[model samples]
Target: MHGGTVRPRRGWGGVPKINVYLPDDLAEGVRAAGLPVSAICQRALEASVRRVAAIRRTALSAHEDPTAGLNQFTDRARTAIRTAAGRSRAAGGQLGTADLLHGVLDEGANLGVRVLRALGLDPAALAAALPQRPQDPVGAASFTATASAALELAVTEALALGHDFVGCEHLVLGLLAEPDGSAGALLRDRGADLRPARQAVVAALVGLTRAAPDPLHPVLARLDRLERHTGLAP
Candidate 1:
């Protein structure tokens, strides 16, 4: 693939012209997230394309694909957020990250929540504890950068261990693995001990490998079982 100056391709009968104008705050967020504006746009577009491809692949699978049906939650979350934001704005309220997290919870993705439960972490709890936005203008960029880096490291760990997809377990592992991350520090401040949890995850992964199943499959399957055990429905 070319690194730069790649032209957009014509598709869907003809090339469609599109433009995205980032708000000043959002543009700052992109920069704070340690991504150039172009990189941010490219990744967002790529994810959308890959999601559609994943749906098509799911439709071709004979066995049940949990991810196939799970994607509706994104659209539902987005719609709920838009609706809530509209109402809030009508009432002269400003929308923020708390509103977004609430929207995600409102979509009721049990599978997602289950994974969090498996790690003894709750998104709702984290959402409540997290600052919706940084109060200090000077630290806003650094705060987001730290969060982004933690997320990236967590994802990288999963992939490096031969995992095929990311789930809530990865998020937990990421937080626990990153001693210097904001989320990790917060968890520590709340008296959560990650050392034991990390050892347990490592042991479980080793045991899973000894069972002779596809390594990635077991990781994902174990995660699913953990979800069900926690009473989260797919």
Candidate 2:
């Protein structure tokens, strides 16, 4: 009745809502952009919090905090991206988001890739979808190796669906896309419903509203940093 209350709404998840305030100019910006003010505010706040937490996570290795570990993941990932981009430039090719993703996947030191492997993804399968790297007359550097067709398709799906980056959820969707692929077969074998799973991820990505303080809310902010760090999005 006053500010937006967490009324049990009708939907797949019965999501909750929170009330907030915005300045006149901010409200105008939201209106001119044809956006939901509450959602925009929530997203910005979430992103900021995540960025701080992620940086902190990387700075302090001794702390066993979950936030610490998550930030470390991003830190390691950014480092790998920079290294791969250097390789690509050395070979004369411009680095791109796909290139960065390939770098992340190839970085044997990171636990993110390991987590994907544990979830039944065969890294080799991704290789099959890789696009031919740009070749300079002088043989510009090779940046990202080709991903599997399934992996490419997954990335394509995320882009087509208007997502800025291919996160873990997108990877899961990609795995599901490959029915005959290793990850797909594994998920299916385990009785995982790909459609529902995808929907759930989408819901989390879209409808799951959050306030500034939640731990997981920072995922978007961390993603923004990743985008800039990897040269994924300007």
lDDT of each: 0.45, 0.47
lDDT of 2 at 64: 25
Name the regions of candidate 2 deviating beyond 4 angstroms.
1-73, 132-234
Q: What RMSD, rounded to one decimal, does every model reach?
A: 16.3, 16.0
Per residue, candidate 2 scores C-alpha lDDT tens digits across 77-180 of 45544444543554566444445445556665554355445555555555444444443333333312222443354454454344544445554565566555
Supply candidate 1's per-residue lDDT for 185.
Answer: 69
Give the runs in model 1 whose Cα sits over 4 Å from its true position: 1-112, 133-143, 193-234
Estimated TM-score per prediction? 0.35, 0.32
Q: Report the C-alpha displacement of residue 119, candidate 2, in angstroms.
A: 3.8
**Model 2 TM:** 0.32
